[model samples]
Target: MSRRLKNNMLTTIAYVVVLLWLFPMLYMFLSSFKFESQVAVPSLTFTPTLENYRAVVTPEFFKHLNNSVLVTAGTVAVSAILGVLGAYALVYSSLKKANNIYFWFITTIFLPAVAVITPVYIVLAKLHLLDTKLALILLNTGAGIPLMIWMCTTYFKEIPGEIVEAAKIDGCSKAGTFFKIMLPLIKNGIISSALLVFIVTWNEFFFAVTATATQSATLPVYMSKFMTQQGYFWGKMSAAGTMVVIIPILIGFFTYKSLVRGLTAGSVKG
Candidate 1:
């Protein structure tokens, strides 16, 4: 085939694959609007209504939403604070050349969270943090901190050393320089990392499902209730699932432009 034709063929293949990957999301979205009785009759002929959305607006739904929001907000706040502090320390401290410390920090990224759940559960149980938002907040922040630090450190390390020197020369304290200069400079990175942390916390199932009971259950755990002892409640499940899926996605969308720039900020010099 000619090069132009080959390029067109590749483009076509890419579009096909993209559509294939999106098919399930599209199906779930459509099925979510469907009533339980209409689920079996899979046709697009029925008019889409706010019935499912209405179902999602109940007190129970709001309770789960509130829990999710609380956990996600707490996780993002804690993670961002710790990430910024940790990243700044690692970059500016005497241990900058300590490869062992850096290596351990980087290695934490590879540790499967499931491996640590037992210890976390024991600790939480002992502290009476089980079935509490505080437990999820602390756990999610700790779980996400490794990656948050990694991203923040990479971005912070790329910052010009002259800026720090300039800040110090201006009689700025270390903490002042960090808060005034570095924080503003790396705001994008902070937002990006916070968004990612929020996404992970919002969709957190294993920890939320296992650690929390109904009182503190997040959206993911609450939605799981749709799968009853007898069988699945497809309508309610779809409604809950759709709601659960949209919040973080909407959060990402709002910050997406900044996040893209932040993720790539250090990758290019000019």
Candidate 2:
């Protein structure tokens, strides 16, 4: 086949794949405005209604959403702050075992949540933190730290060692150099890490279901209420899911460039 024909075939395949990937999300979004009866049918010709959205916007839903925002924001902030410092130390410190330390950090990412949940639960219960937003915040921050370190460390290592040496020679303290120089240079990496951490914490279901009750329940936990003994409230569930997805989508849309740049930065070198 000619190169042009091959390119056309590849483009067609890409479009098909994109459509396939998007179909479920598109159907869910459309169903959020549909009636309970209309959800089972795949046709898009039915009239849209606001009842599902209305049902999803109750006080309880908002409360859970507020909890999600707090937990996600707190987790991201804590993870980013700690991750930056840890990554900087790993990259610039003189420790002979820095590589080994990094390897250990990477291992945490592979550890399944199920493996540690029992111990974590016991510790939280002993601390009287169950059903509290602070518990979720702390848990998410710890869970996200490993990923933050991995991403930020790669970005930090890409920085020129000469600049760090020059900063030291000029009598800049380690703290001053990190605050004034390194952070600004790696701003994209931080933003990217924050965005990823926010999405993960926001969508986290297992810990939210286990760690919190009504008082501190997040959006995912709120949506779970739709699964009743009678049947799944598909309409309301879709509506709540739609609302839960909007913030992350908006963040990604606005920061697409920065996220892409941050993720791809250390993948190649000049």
TM-score of each: 0.87, 0.95
lDDT per residue for candidate 1 within 71-123, as digits (tens), equals: 88888888888877887778778875755665677798787879999999999
Candidate models: Cα lDDT each: 0.82, 0.91
Best by TM-score: 2
Q: Model 1, which residues run further than 4 Å from truth?
A: 1-14, 37-42, 47-51, 266-270
The lDDT leader among the candidates is 2
Q: Could you give candidate 2's per-residue lDDT for residues 64-163 as a string of tens digits?
A: 9899999999999899889888888888888889999988989998888889899999999999999999999999988889889988999898888899
Q: What C-alpha lDDT, on a 0 to 100 scale, does residue 3 get in candidate 2?
A: 100
